[model samples]
Target: MSAFSDVELLHDFLTEAGDLLEDVDSKLVELEQSPEDAELLATVFRGFHTIKGGAGFLEATHLVELCHKTENLFDKLRSKKLLLDAEMMDSIMAATGEVHRMFGEMRNGHQPGAAPVELLDALDAAIEGRTVAAAAVVEQVAIQTASEQAHSPVVAEDDLDWAGLYEAVVGVAPRELEQAALSTGMATEAISRQAAAAVRPKAPASKAKAAGPATTTAKENSIRVDTVRFDQILNLSGEIGLTKNRLSCLFQSINAGVVNDDLIKSLDTVVGQLDMLVSDLQSAVMKARMQPVGRVFQKYSRLARDVSRQLGKDVELVIEGAETEVDKSILEELNDPLIHLVRNAVDHGIETIEDRIACGKNPKGIVNLSARQTGDHIVIEIQDDGRGMRPEIIREKAVEKGLISSEEAGQLSVQESLQLIFLPGFSTKDQISDISGRGVGMDVVKTNIQRLNGRIEIQSEPGHGSKITILLPLTLAILPVLMLKLEEQIYSLPLSSVREIIPIEEDRVQFVSGKPTMVVRGEVIPLLDLATLIGRESNPGPKVGVLAVSGDRACILAVDSLVGQDEVMIKPLEGIKPKGVAGATLSGEGLLVLVLELRELIEGKL
Candidate 1:
């Protein structure tokens, strides 16, 4: 294989190896709680064994040796000769870190540094003083049985054809396997044989049953096909849709002229059917990119455990809606924000054990992560049972930082004050710590989430807990919008942001402090004219189209006319933030229009 192929193969191996390592950490944490779980121990042993084998083939002697030693310690525990204690668990956890560092160094195209020899010696020492008399007796019985069978016909176990079994177990493409083999310095054929052997059942009865299926059972297998194929299909489907749209335009022109009504009606029906088929195809292709949130949520178990241990706090992390699926792209971008949030919950949001207990709460605080689909949005929430935010303290900090006047802070609601923490360079901690309270994380969280066109909401009670809810579009590719007219130009508003629309008489509007205000349901709500805000003023008319948009606060938008609702594909404004525009969309009338940013518009009001 070429060098490029080798690099690609190694990169893929590194990705999978990282995932496996994370799994091992999580399993180890679970074993801490259920120390006597035999199956869990077996699973951990197999994972380490697999890592060792892979590293050995790659000539990563240091990594292989580390895993080998770790595996030996597990072997002693599995055989009931050694007991699992806190010290042993800590040592194993440190070994996990060592292996991870070695893998990281190897991924960066350098040799891994030697691990601490003392740690290796300590691991070896843990296996001493174990009575293996029962293990030896069992080995003797197996050896005797094998010796008894040696006198009979010697059928070679290695003679079994294993190509089908290899495909069933690994499910990697033949070429990918070949590349992996070349990179790892193993013969492709040998690696394939080993994969088959690894998956084979040890029981004699299962081996006998493997030979009975002669009817060519279609394999019932799958491969991890590249996502680029689905993307291509989606692009082609989009082109077909555009063609259908143009054809509809032609049909409208024909209907306006002298045409056969029957033919026109038949053509319309066919076009509608084709449109539905194309939509279904798009939906199916998009679903292929959907992955359950559990893939990302699983890593939190290890993170929570390690961070809580380091901080000397006892915290339990719980996950819900692990089965909710989102686009792969969204899932990938969401990892950092989620990590930051979890770390913040542990480091800042949750109080210490004594503090929590004194507050009449569980000493081991609970951090719950959940996601669910609501309309066209996916709502992900992180709630922590800790000392929630105190609005008064936040107000004092804001006043000290000059973020708000003391009088303004005194009148602010709890929800509004909690949002002040998200401001840039705002920290509530008295002293900066390594973990958090440096006033850096939450701002980045808000910025990154906004770049994805998502909104975050904070809810808290002083003594209960706090919940941060994030609302994101299901897919960024397409969105449902409400199209409205401002003067002669049409603009779109994401339906997710729009609350409602109402027609109001111009006479009922009042000016409050040189700004337009309207009374709706006994509440004074601020109103902004869409044209004037976008720098295009129009003459006052008899009635105004009021678009009520709600974010952290509610605002009324006055436009010229309500065009209608639409399901338009949002095209981002690249390299520039348009004046008072959130995004641009193509209307059914073949016109380009801008979408207003409701949050920005409301913020501009202050």
Candidate 2:
């Protein structure tokens, strides 16, 4: 039904174009920082040119028209026919965003609509020697060369009446300040504070209307793997088949009554070979699912640039250890949580430019996004060199929001207080902005990380900065868990959450605030009975206790006995999923054992 005739060609174009556009975005951001980098400029130009050629081949007129305009703009930029400025860069960024939108439509087998009239006019404006600023708010903060901004001077707040200035530049009455703020994409709070302190005039909106995040989902069905890895998989599969044939022959020989040591030995050798082969095959497949974290990391540079500019803050997102590999499935789910954290670092964690200068810190705040692998887990950190969080302040905010009682707030340690931010509807901000403050950002970050069988830790020092560390298993396909016995049935806790299996000492168990508690090395840990947590009869005199931690909360889980540890593949329950149970796995004896959701159980009990 679509006008595009070649479906396969279109699919290939979308795949390649998506990657090209992402690279272009990163480079464009860099280009703004270093406008004289001819190589970067050429690379960006070629990116658009290649995309335009593909669209032309596919007869996607809308896509081609958009790309051609962008390519020409870059062409002029490279030729020195037009001096690049923040305004032109805004138009370029907007054009790329529109291209991404068009890709979305083509993916659905529909031809994209034409570029907006305003965008074409802006492109035409750039082509000529006039400044044709688009209407509304700027989508990006233009990165200008030193020479371009050198003539601009910082104006003191007392030097000008902001109300008169706003009316003069924006052609609106002072009473319409809020409406004007909306049109310029500045928060009203920012306008009230007269925060547009930059000497340059406010940049106009991009030619295209504000484009939200390119509509993408975490459920990608296709993945790319290296040919070498595929070959390794094939080689292992072939070896496994040969071993299976040998195993079959050995079984036949035994059934034929050849009772020699040679026959028995041969059978054992074949069985060992089959076991090793299967293990190798599994490792090979999991390796195939591994992808570099850079694929996700590369997307955030533009994000940081955009949000920082939107907030009128100077922030730089620095990425490290991007070559670290993670499960492809995990990489997809990580996108949103990472976006939230990065935005938080820019909006909440980083101080305003004035505050940073006043605090004797760098005017341009640095946000570090890094990833690395330790053992079988990936550790990611989002660190900001801005205003660090204060435990006391966090606790106070939590109390004010009614998330915790005054007494509860008083009893929390610094670490626990930091964890309070993860509570739903907890925020420290007095004024709400589009970026943050309804208290949902940190909550989502914690929830998503925990859902991946991971844990998040926060470290902060007021005035220094804040660091949020996340630890996640390498793969969700298999889980290593501690098996426990509860009234003759077995349940498993994720090994990552289990600190140790301690024998419950009756003397060590004490009642604190009318709740059962135990002192382990001077730290008091509350004891939650496993049976009681699941609404079953309480287990009296439970001999074994498992020390488990979820988020920053640690507790002792009383169980009937310890069944040791196992690596298992969990299967979902068919119809009914009971609370506190993550999934079902099989025990060594072929019995169905439930895998407990450690965080859910611990939080529910608390």
Candidate 3:
């Protein structure tokens, strides 16, 4: 039953149980709206029952105990022995969260400690039809924590303060620990840092050497591919094999000195056929790696519900286009960014029920989360019907925060002022809380989206609401780029960044602030020499200007000539990372071309 000794068994259990827990979480949120749905009660009961069975099999005593209590409570509800209430739902959710934490512990090859006594007692009381006020418990625990901390003597470095050391290592202070205890009902036991290390399951030498960080969860390394998609890949492989055999026969005939117009034509036709097969195969493989966005979107309903409850707001998250599919890698990286956006919509974008009613709006605010595919890209939007942003307020806040000057703020257009919220350390809230006020979330959302080769745009109207749109590539394996020549060498820029290609006519170009500039429409755009930016000698008489947007800045990249556009599979250069060089790719003629990281190159230039 040791974790290290049964890695494969534990992995299988984790994969199945993790998905079940997520389903249970979403269902619990739904149950809150339809408290009398007997079928939902039954489904949730079975989910916990199944998890408990698996935990029992794996000898996960803590998990089994926790699930056992939660399952029994659901059983009573389904049998009409007890009615579902807000307090009961809160306790159920807290239990589910504790189960998830236990799963994480198991993922790290540790048998989770006992469930908190307070939470277990709360569940037991609910089963007997007694209401437990979760907030009251949290407040009482907080006071006790403060008192304990106030009375404790200060310790020197050599004094070895076990409680303080545990708090630092686990990122949980005494107040949080007490709160966790009440929420989880974990038995009171001092599990210290050294005690945690002592529980690490011993492993064979080879496994010890090959083991990755304990934090590496099984979900990160696994993907679920539909059988139909896998079959498509297999069929494509067979077609490719047949085409390769035909090409081999054609090559032999040519080698036998039978070169003729007919033979050459046959070779050309086969090569073209082979090209088509390879493309189809590549597409099939990429399809195998695609997953529905609902996999990530399903959990957000629960998230929105939790945030609204904590804030004492009546907010509902409406999801759309959940069936749209995107690359699995993008889905994983997207979760955190989307969480920030959703929380922001509820915490900042949505207004309090009382305020909403006062403004002659619906008492309950609505946050819409949606996703869909457009061409080769995926678009995700988080929209909220709450108090819309005021550009002047945003501008004043930016000025106050020293993110922008008064002069600069005064000149910013309405849309530009709204963009200031994405600036680091810029927030409209006067007070900081566990949510929203620190102003780090939106900045992180922008950075993470950009890292995925994506762009985010914010739009808000006074008295209306705010909508944040995210545009991302369908896949990161192939990058659509704008190819250009720098004398003899060629380079590529992400096509998403390139707005247009214009001729660099001498009459149209002018000098502004001693730097080459051009007027595009009404905006003055700075011109940057591509060769100079990449530390290469500039080619004389560069005639092409690429109108590109890197991050939020627009500039013209001067190049020798435009070579059209292409989609290239990027290949990383091992043991070498040149600044501004994203990756390397091969052109049609087998020439190596560097894919430019435009944002990095133009970061400070504009």
Q: Which has the greatest TM-score?
A: 3
* Backbone clashes under 3 angstroms, per model: 0, 0, 8
Rank ordering of all candidates by lDDT, starting from the highest = 3, 2, 1
Greater-lDDT candidate between 1 and 2: 2
Instruction: For candidate 3, write residues 248-343 as lDDT tens digits.
Output: 998999899999999999999999998998999899989988999998898888788888888899888889999999999889778778878888
- Superposed model 1: Cα runs more than 4 Å off: 1-5, 56-62, 94-262, 356-362, 414-420, 447-464, 485-489, 502-550, 557-562, 573-585, 594-596, 600-605
lDDT of 2 at 264: 85
What lDDT score is found at residue 407 in candidate 3? 93
lDDT computed for candidate 2: 0.77
TM-score of each: 0.69, 0.81, 0.83
TM-score computed on alpha carbons, candidate 1: 0.69
Q: Considering TM-score, which of the candidate structures 1 and 3 is the better prediction for this target? A: 3
Candidate 3 lDDT trough over 10 residues, lowest sum = 150-159
Q: 1 or 3, which is superior by lDDT?
A: 3
Q: Give the TM-score of candidate 2.
A: 0.81
lDDT of 1 by residue, 1-606 (tens): 333236666666666776788789778878988887998898899889988887766677888888999898899889887888756776677778777778768767766787777667667766674333221121112112212212111112322222333343234432244333223333334433444354344326654455334222222122233577577677768777776886777678777884777767867776786777678777766677677788778777767766776677888888999989887767766776787788788877788998988888878888999999997779999999888888899889989988789999988887889999888878888787655666776777776676566888999887788999998877866767788876555677777777777676777788899887888878788877776665455647744555555445677788778788888655543322333455555566444455666655555564
Candidate 2's C-alpha runs over 4 A off are: 1-9, 135-218, 486-489, 504-543, 572-578
